[model samples]
Every structure is written in structure tokens, then in C-alpha cells.
Target: MDGTVDITMPAELEGTRAVVRSWLKSVGETVRRDEPLVELETDKVTTEVPAPADGVLLEILLERDAEAEPGALLGRLGARAAEPAAPTAEPEVCSRQSAAPAPPALEQVREHRLSPAVRRAVGQHGVDISVIRGTGRDGRITRADVDALVAARASAPASGSRIVPHDRMRRLIADNMLASVTTAPHVTAVFEADFSAIIAHRAKHKAAYERDGVSLTYTAYIVAACVAAMRAVPVINSRWHADHLEIFEDVNIGIGTALGDKGLVVPIVHRAQELSLQAIAARLHDLTARARSGQLKAADMKDGSFTISNHGVSGSLVATPIIIQQPQSAILGVGKLEKRVVVREVGGVDTIQIRPMAFVSLTIDHRVVDGHQTNAWLTAFVQALESFGD
Candidate 1:
């Protein structure tokens, strides 16, 4: 059988239009089985369309930067060159009138080898797979490679004014943020929290935590406090369903990690309420590390009942009305920790004291949470931090 195959888009990219970023293999070039033939970029990720079988690229139906839908034929491949037929003795008119069967249509197959994260990155950037230096086993492309490419592109200085295109992640983040604000009436309640106790506790246990290979950060303490608060007020750990509110039994906290100009990703710590302070610290450390390294799995970003954006890491003083992650009732925003003067009563005399303090804000979905509930959650959070022991 003459081995001719049609290269189509992967099924995972359904419902999305991808731009033909670039072709790694030109027509007449031989492509090995599973070798990348072309790069397709979508809004969510950039990925390569691999050759189904060992063959030579025979034709290209879509050129670079052309828009294509899922299952659209991008090109064709031939297993081998067609053999020449024997000379026919029939007249030219008789040969023109001869009936012959049409060739069979090529089968449509989806690429099943790419990981979800890698696929997302591919569709997002329309990356040129050939240009990427893969560090994975067997020379496979990983999300980190795509991120490196993105970072390099971002860092390069442009010679003139140019419009930079948004990757899939950025576009999705924008759409989600816009939807969150439009879907729910957001109200933020700010509270000044004394972090002296938590800070002292961390300092005291820092040695032991480091010995155990965990860096005890203030964010861990905040997350532990959030778990306590969530247990006390389950509504804060709930989602707003169309007909009713659904409070989850387990607290899955999403810690927002900023990816420079790439946007943000919220990787969740599942069953956070069941974990101890040390466990929470270790897990948060792992998740954040993986998040920044572009190693987070799809599950790492799922089932988040609550989200915490610790904007303070970047020296943000305070962020008001931080948009609540959709479906979740609220999001916690922690500001930079600093020393501040406070008035205290000592032996019935007014005394001034410097304390480590941070401003905490809780932005809630008014549709599922009320002002009283918001205040209650913040109170519990603050109390946990102030009275923190061990």
C-alpha cells in the first residue's frame, strides 16, 4: 500500500483556533515517527503536531501564521516515492476516458504522547519545537523549555514599537479576572494584624525547620491560620453555586504564584486543613517551587476552595478588593510585614511599643458571603496569628 498520511491537529485542542506558528519539517523533508512536524499556538499553550509515521512531508496545506481548527489538515506525508507505471499502448483519447478508483482518505489521529502541561504550553506560545533545546529524557520537550523560551523572548529588547501578543495563560487570566468581577459583587474588609507572635514562633523554630529541610516562611503561618479560620467559618471555604452554596469538607488552599510577565498560577495544597504547621510549610514550599519552575501538574491547580495572594513577597503594601477566584467565596491578601508603633496599656499607663505587623485583606463574593461573615473570618485569621504558639 502506498503509505500516505494526513497530519491533523490534536483533539485536546478542540474548540480552539490555533495559528500555524512554524513548520519544523519542510516539504520533501523526512520526518521520523513521533518527531515534531509543526508547531501550533493556541491561547492556552503552544505544542507541536508530531508525525504519525516515518515518512517524507509531501504537501503543506496550512502555512505559518495561518489559522486552523482542530482536526484541520495541516499537511500530508508519503511513506515512499510513487513507482512509475508501465507505458500504456491505448490511444490518448481512450486513456482520458478510463475510469479509475480515487485514493482512500487519510485517517485522522490525535497526538497522545504530550503531557497536559506541555500541551498547554505548546498551544499557548506556538513555539518552534525544533528551536527548543529539550532537557527531558529521550530529548522530549517539557514545560520548562517553553517557559525558558518565553522568558528569553520577554527579556529581549525590541528595536522599535511593537505589539506583543498575549499567550494563552495571559488571555485566560484576563478572561477569568473579568468574569470574576462581573459575576460577583466584591467587597473587601481590611484588618491590621500583629504578626509578632507568628514571627517569634518562626524565629524560635527556624533552626529545627531548617534542620528538617523546610524553610518556615510567614506565608506558611498565614496558610495555617487560614485553615483554622476556614474550619471556624466554613462559609469562607465554600463556593457559590447557581442555586445554592457548596461548602467543601476539605480545605484546598490555592497559593498564587506570580510568573513575572507570564501571569499568575494558583497551585493548590490539597486537604490543607488536615495537615500540621510543619507539613503545611513543606507542602507550600514544594508547590511554590514547582509552580515557578513550570512543573505543576493539572491536578496541582484544581479543586481550590480558597485562594491566597501573598502580594507582600513583592513589597506590595496592600491590595484592596482583590478579585475573588471564581466559584470560591473569598481570597486572602497579605501585605508586607514591617515593624510599626502601637499604643499599649501597661499597669493602667499608656505605653508605646513597636510590633511586627501586616495588613490583611479579605475580598469576598457578596453573593455568597456577607459583611458580618467576612469580618468574622478576618477576626479568626488575625487571632490565630496573634496567639500563635509553637
Candidate 2:
């Protein structure tokens, strides 16, 4: 007898909805039980749905980027079977010379000729193309036309990109980043913090922390500082909604991890506000290592109330990081940590001394967070860093 068979969205996994991020199998492919079948993405995470049983994939019910609810059948799995009989109903034939519909008539008819790219962009922008002036031959709307109108009447020069193929993750990143930039009126505030205290704290704890399996890096300190900072400046943890501002009480910070040549992934640390400094360090290390090794799950990237990009890992002194807009109002960028000489007053005597310092930039959505609030948060963040006991 054939084995019992059924497919399901991954359980206990965040974002199991059938918005496709990747497909691990093709139709007619024999898949083993527990093997990944398709990768699904939520706004902030990507996860794979595994095959339900060892069987031949008989049918794919959904295409990539198709939306599906949890527990919806994504495909059928069973032994290969012969083709079934066609429907017995007489095939309806339509005349090619049918009269063109009026504007009202066309409104009811679904147009299927839209290219995938155009469809995606239009759906994403929620654009009403009927109002756009088309420049294509015969007034057919083109992708370029949609893009041009999306960038309409902008004082700043349009950002250009040479067309290049991107994998699913990169594509998602592109879409989200573009959406954030377009939707949010971003304003970046810069802060220069003396890192001497942070250096002393790390130096004092580094050895013991490492012995306990923690890296004891500046990231943990920053994470703690950011948690305190977010609590102090609650506006930084808010999003602008259609009719109101949504404030998030828990701080889930997304740590931006670079994925070598593919792109970057920001795996979130849920409730970073609740995690201790050591716990944050341990989680950050694990996530970063796994992220680089491509072992991260979709849940690791979901539900971020804020983002932290440690661009300083590559020696960048300071950067105006872009905010990931959605349920988050801002992103904090950490620049390279280095020792530099600066003037200091010691016991009323002015002297030059070398001390560790790093630059931080908080890019916030101006619609939700003002510059004064952003600056206040950064100041509080620096104060937190300066207060870390050695």
C-alpha cells in the first residue's frame, strides 16, 4: 500500500506562511522525509518547510512568491502515477475577434499579461497605474515606466543600479531595503563616544568571559547599551502606522551579519532588553557564526524592533546606516573601534592620551522619530557605555 502522505508548513517556526523565498525541490523530484522542500519568508525571516514523507513530489500547487496560509497544501507527495483523464465538459472556445471591452467592462476582467517584475513592483508600491502616463509603444506600460513614476519629482538624484541577478535572500533584502528607503523619511544622527570605559570593561572581563564560552566583545556592551538607550528613548522603538504611532515595549535587536559574496543577513535577538550582557554576547556569537555558515533559521531574522549594524567589524570608523522600516523606527550603526590620541584634563592639567573610541550613527524615520529624540538616545547610549563597570 502507498504510504500515508501530506505536506505541512513548518511548525513552531516563525513565518510559515507560503510566501516563497526559495524552492528546494522541483516537480517529480523524489524527496526524503524531513528534507527541506521549500523555503518561506516572513518580513524579517526565512525558513524552509520540510517534506512530510519520503515520496515522489507529484504536484506543486503554488509557485514562488505565492502567498499561502499555514497548514495550506503547498504540493502533493505520492508515488508517480499515470496522467488522469481530462475534464468531460465540452471545451468552451472563444472567438479571437471579440470586441474590446469598455473601461468599466475591462475593470472586471483580470489582466494576466503583466510580467513578474512589473507585478511585484506594482503590488509592492500599491500603485494605481491608470493615472500614470505611459511612454511605451502603443502606450503599453513598462517596468521602467513604473519605476520612473515611483521616483517622480524627487530633488535628490535617483539611485542607479545595473541589473544583476540576485538569489532569493538578496532579492528579499533588495525589496525590503528599497521599501524602507522609499517609505521612510530617514534622518541620521551621528555621535562620537569615548570608548575608554568600554575598553577597560572588556579588558577586565575578556579572559574570564572567554573561559565561560563567551567572546566578551564590544557588541555585547553595545547591545546592553542599546537596550538601555531604547528604554530611555521609547520613540526609537516605534513605527509609524496609517492612523497612529505603534510603540514596541520589548526590544528585539537585529544584528546585521555580512554573508560574504551573497549579501547580508540581520538575525534578530528577541528581547535583547531581557538578556544579560553575557547572554547577549553568547547569542550574538552563536548567531553570527551560524549566519556566516548558512545555518540560521527564519525565526532568527524575525520581529525586530531595532537593528544594529556592526560595520566597524571591517574597520569602518563611522557609517550612516539605513533603517529597516516596518515595525522598527531606527537602526544604529557601530563604527570601527580603535585607539586614538585626544586631549584630556587630568587633575586640572591638560594632557594628550590614547583612548579607544568608536563612532555611532542612528538613522531614524523622521515621520516617527525626531532628531532631538534620536540624539538624546545616542547620548544615553554613550552614557550607558561610559557607566559599564570594569
The models' CA-based lDDT, in order, is 0.80, 0.74
Each prediction's TM-score versus the true structure: 0.67, 0.72
Summarize candidate 1's per-residue lDDT along 219-253 as a digit string, tens digits: 89989999889877899899888898888999999
Q: How many backbone clashes does candidate 1 have?
A: 12
Per-residue C-alpha lDDT of model 2 across residues 121-225, encoded as one tens digit per residue? 668887776765432223334454566566663333456643433444566667778888888888898888788888888888889989998898788888999
lDDT, model 2: 0.74
Q: Residue 271 in candidate 2 has what lDDT?
A: 92
